[model samples]
Target: MDLPRITARRSEGGWELEIAGLGPAYVKRLSDVSEHGRTLMQAAGVTGSEHGVQVKVDLGDELNERVRSATQATVDAHRAQLEAAAEMRRTTMSLRGHGMTGRDIAFILGISPQRVSQLLSSHQL
Candidate 1:
């Protein structure tokens, strides 16, 4: 009736687990599970060590969910900023095509000519 003991932590790339008292074989099995993106489950006698002890590891689901949500928020914010910049570029380009000079475009856009040039170059128009 031996049981494995597991402790896990969240990292920037993924989850990390430190299993105490686990044999090499069992550690390999746990590592395999993690590589395949599966949570390690607590099971008895899975390690088959001479000592009646093992270690199980997995990530905290609640924390992972929060991290995912935050990441999505950041991505959305960046997308919005890019969309706004593209819109400004379109407006400035239209005004320039109508015979406006770089200074006039900058004044109308309330930005520098360098910034307008960068945006136009990025859009390739």
Candidate 2:
């Protein structure tokens, strides 16, 4: 049977993690955690927090390399999403500039007219 892969990302205080096929979680660095929480995180490799558990993964060189690769992939995916959204907005503005109505843009873009209006209002374009 196949299981979901866990992705790790570097965040402000620590790491954000997402389990494939499941929801996401965040884990702060040991230094950022409270003294009591840090102790638990060290001893058990994790400690519970408001959102989820903060984790410490002490890994061998090979595992560290794998984690780094996964993290990069996650970051790259997020960047791609931002780029795509920007492209979509550009295309929408171009179509509007050509005198296409919101309903026309929505039908052409396969989105609801309300969503078209929202996009226009959001970007103020």
Candidate 3:
């Protein structure tokens, strides 16, 4: 049985695997892996059962490094967004506690008064 040509590349948050020459049975097995929270592998085509399960792991160290870097960048960006949101909430609350109206808070924070009202109402602040 000839082995399938397998190639893998780093994707945004995971790996993109490509498998060629996979039979229906083998393709089902790959889908099972994904459903079970194991490594994700997708079959691109089917030729014949004589090919067995031609497997390939093409992602090397360099690709792994890039994936890791991209993941870290995404995490950092999300963290910054969360921190900014928290800061905005804190500033808004502080201003409100110091006798500021919704209009005043909105002007100080450079947001619409309606948004300020919504935030304050939702947060019960």
Candidate 4:
């Protein structure tokens, strides 16, 4: 991003904005994002012609690590689903090659005959 990043931490009364070169500034809770940006700009001494800054909210180290871990778990679950689908498609093709009927393959894989037909017609599953 082109804007400078400012760290915001929850504090008594409102929040604490830590600007890189300029230490920390305390601000009362604002109603909207733009208002917060405007207040941050004034505290950081940004010129009127310049745009607003980027604010990074800090919820503490433990909470941040939990958020990251949850995000990674979601990504890993999606990847596993994709891999399982691919493996099912490969197994279906292999069974069909052994002269097995769609109905028989469906019974073996616990899926419908229509699904077996679909797997046979396309490379993706």
TM-score of each: 0.49, 0.53, 0.53, 0.67
- For TM-score, the strongest prediction is 4
What lDDT tens digits, residue by residue, belong to model 3 across residues 58-124? 4688877897899999999999999988788778888999999999999999999998887777667
Span of 10 residues, lowest total lDDT, candidate 4: 29-38
**Cα lDDT over the full model 4:** 0.78
User: Per-residue lDDT for 64 in model 2?
Assistant: 86
Model 2 error, position 27 (Å): 17
Off by over 4 Å in 3: 1-58
lDDT of 1 by residue, 1-125 (tens): 66544554545544455555442223234445343222333232345333333434444788778878999999999999989877998897798789998888888889998987886677684
CA shift of 77, model 2, Å: 1.1
Of 3 and 4, the candidate ahead on lDDT is 4
Q: Model 2: runs farther than 4 Å from truth?
A: 1-56
Q: Residue 81 deviation, candidate 4, in Å?
A: 0.8
| CA error at residue 45 for candidate 2, angstroms | 24
With a 3 Å backbone cut-off (N, CA, C), the pairs that clash in candidate 2 are none
**TM-score head-to-head 1 vs 4, winner:** 4
Tell me how far the alpha carbon of residue 114 in candidate 2 is from the true structure, in angstroms, after superposition: 1.7
Clashes of each: 3, 0, 0, 0
- Model 3's alpha-carbon lDDT is 0.61
Among residues 3 or more apart in sequence or in different chains, the pairs in candidate 1 whose N, CA or C atoms overlap within 3 Å are 4-54, 5-54, 5-55
Clashing pairs in 3: none
